[model samples]
Target chain A: MALLGILLFLMIIGAVIAVETRNLLSSIVCLGAIGFLLSIVFLFLGAPDLAITQLVVEILCLVILIRATIHRRVETVAGNREFVGLAVTVVMLAIVLMLAISMMAGFPSLGTSVLDRMAQAPSHFYLLQGKAQTGVTNIVTAILLDFRAYDTLGEATVLFCAVMGALAVLRRSARRRPEEGDAGDEGEGGAE
Target chain B: MSGGTHQGGMSLIVRTVTRWLKAFILLFGIYVVLYGHVSPGGGFAGGVVIACAYILLTLAEGRERTARLLSERLAAVLAVAGLLFFLGVGLAGMVGGRAFLDNFLVGDSGAEPALASGGIIELCEIAIGIIVSMSLFLAFAVLSRFRVSLGDGDETATGEGGAS
Candidate 1:
């Protein structure tokens, strides 16, 4: 519990730094830190799979953000008008914190009742019958690959489509010839 | 100028570490994808790991080297092949009078957890892993290339008459 509290405190600090930092790289690094902390929190909550996915996704996000920000200049913040934005941010943060605290305070008892009802739910059915029905030891894998195969297929298709779209968009410049010699040389240099 | 100058990627230390660690990361990813049915990781997670390995390689080495290793064309082909393989596995279940993606290989369920235990699940995992890894690598490659083109355009706009 103390460890979790420390993690939450660090997460809050990271979130604040990510939002308030003027340097894009620092903001991205703070975001990655928050993601790492969140993954640890997930592991503490007994979701090792989620933690692994979260960590990898966080790394990928950091890579993508860094690539995007590589050639861009550092962001500059306006001083006087930024005060209004800060005030608004503080107000929003206070409201969210109050709501989150209330939710956390109310969650455990509410979760117990929900879990009690869910004990007799389909989760129990999967826990008991998943192995026999799917011939897989891991219930999650059985559910994803056997019981819920169609959903997974749909997700795969969506991923494929998204990739296709990205490829199409990015390959446009490659398809078009460079209009000038200087641009062509620069393109070759960049490609190398 | 000195030939020792590394113009593209990071310093020597990072490049050396990345070179040594790349193979291990790729091996771990394959292990995760293969053992997904019995382990915590699945196809998507393993695929992401594999893609990250390549992305790291691209970051450490130059783009030309990475592209020569796994070109965009190869990545595209692999992505398509993975999707076909996944669909083929699903369609194959229809042959044995089962539903799509049905686990037809009802072998001895009481046997030890081996490679061939999960019927079509393992096959699907491999297929998904290939699709995801290749597609992600392709996306990264293309996006970086596009950013280069954008940068080139900026340079051209700035140096239009001056270069002439």
Candidate 2:
């Protein structure tokens, strides 16, 4: 619990640094740090798989963000608009914190459940029958690839759509630039 | 912009490290995907790891080199092939008088966790891994190429015209 609190505090600091930094690269680096910390927290919370996923996803996001920010100017948003945004964010944060604290008061402690026996039966059934039904030792994998295979298929389809959409948008932009006749000169051949 | 022309990526040390680690990363990804039935990682995680290896290569060795290794057209084809393989596996199961994605193989469960244990699940994992890795690599490749094309605006026009 203390470790969790420490992680949460560091996360908040990292988030603030990410938001407030004028350097886009530093902001992305800070964001990656937060993601790494959050993945560690996930591991502590007994979700190693989630931790692994979070780490890899965070790395990929960082790579993409860095790529996008390259060749772009890093401009800081300042003045009255920034102050107003900060004020609104603080207010929202306070409200969220209050609500979360209140909700936590009603929840049971670790290793204890607010849910009744009947409500917990499905998980118990899975723990007992997962291996026999799926011939897989890892219950999580069995559940994901066997019991909930359809959901995974749906997720794959969504991924496919997203990739296709990105390609289509890129292709359209490439096509449009030619007709505009405002083509800039070719620059470097390698990474910038 | 001209700086990129001179030094494509980082100095010698970083590039050397990346080159050495790239193979291990790719191998680990395949291991994760193949052992999904008995391990912590599944197709998605493994695929992302695999994609990261290519991304690392691009970041280190430069886009031109990576493009030569796995071109956009090949990536697109691989993505489609992965999806088709997945669909084919499901259809195969259905054709065997079972439900879609059913485990059709009638072998006894192995004593130890082996590749042949899970009938259709292992195959599905492989398919998913291929789809995810290829799609992600394709997305990154397309985005990077788009950025380059935008940078070299006139070149895109001529290239597109020639291709068409």
Candidate 3:
């Protein structure tokens, strides 16, 4: 309960700071902090893997956002458009929070014991028969790699595609011709 | 010195520290990749660490040097290797007369919990980790190089044309 209270306090403070800050970079960093803190709370709630995945994805998103924003003009004051954006963001956040609260109120916890029992049942029989061969201690890994390996394969393929797509977009404006590069080099040499 | 205005100048001590930190990051990344199953460290974590290290190295040593160190060929090869390793692990199970990625058919699943206990699932984790980290590092390296080049061009246009 205390942990939840702390998280709530930090989140509120973070939200306020993110909205109130005039410096664009500071606001972005604050948003990243809020994300990191939220993920830490997730970890404390027995969701370490989700916490790690969220933390990584959030940090990457933050970096990409900051990098893009760095190249753009930062308005010191919140304009009308900015106001609208903030309002929309707040509305979305509120709706999501309400949904989460309501859903969690009715949600039954899927304890590890059930998963353990599953691992020890058909899976156990397979093991005893020398037919179950997955060696991951973490049941999540076992499920991910063995029982639902097809889904994991699909997700991995998607991630690989995304990486390739990003690389393609980025490589478009890369150094293309040696001549152009050489021209730039010669120009630099002449200037020096 | 293909020095760009945007690339901030650092003192000797700062450069030294950055270089040392870069080495530590590289070593840490390798550790995470290799011991992913046994520890909290895994492929995604290791890959991000390596990406951070490459970014740091780029900041310290400049774009051209960073590019040379992380050649496109090396990144591509690593990415391919990671993918192939993961696929190979899965394929091994199919060869054992079971469905695709059926590790139990290969005598790797449902073992004891000792160091030599667990079976093929452990290998799959390690493979997944490798693929994830390698792809991430490759993506970051390629993307950042593109950014640095554009940044270099902007610097040159703004009258900072001298090479360092």
Error of 2 at B119 (Å): 1.8
Residue A24 lDDT in candidate 3: 72
Q: lDDT values of the candidates? A: 0.76, 0.75, 0.60
Q: Going through the candidates in order, what fraction of the true interface contacts does each contain?
A: 0.37, 0.36, 0.28
Scoring each candidate complex against the real one, what DockQ results?
0.34, 0.34, 0.32
- The TM-scores, one per candidate, come to 0.81, 0.82, 0.70
What ranking emerges by DockQ with the best candidate at the front? Answer: 2, 1, 3
Which ranges of candidate 3 are over 4 A from the true structure? A50-65, A75-101, A109-133, A176-192, B1-11, B104-118, B145-164
lDDT per residue (tens digit) for residues B61-157 in model 2? 6766777787667877887888888878777878857798766762245457788777778888898898888889878766665653323333232
Task: Point out where model 2 deviates above 4 Å.
Answer: A82-99, A111-120, A172-192, B1-10, B106-110, B147-164
Candidate 2 at residue A6, lDDT?
99
Model 3 Cα displacement at B67 (Å)? 2.8
Worst 10 residues of 2 chain B by lDDT: B155-164
How many pairs collide in each candidate, listed in order?
Answer: 0, 0, 11
Interface RMSD per candidate (angstroms): 6.1, 6.7, 6.8
lDDT of candidate 3 over A1-192, digit per residue (tens): 688779979988998999988777788888998999988888887866557666776776676556444544453543467778889999999999999999998655544444364666665653344334445454544566667677776666676778777777655335443334545454332211
lDDT tens digits, residue span B1-164, model 1 = 11222535555777899999999999999988888877788888899999999998877775666777887789899999999998998898888687988777743467766667888888888998999899888877766555532332342121110000
Compared with the true structure, what per-residue lDDT tens digits does model 1 show for residues A1-192? 788889999999999999998777798899999999999998897767778889887898788777766545653645576778899999999999999998888565521544365677777787788777766776778788887888888888888889999888656544444453334455434322
Between prediction 1 and prediction 3, which has the larger lDDT?
Answer: 1
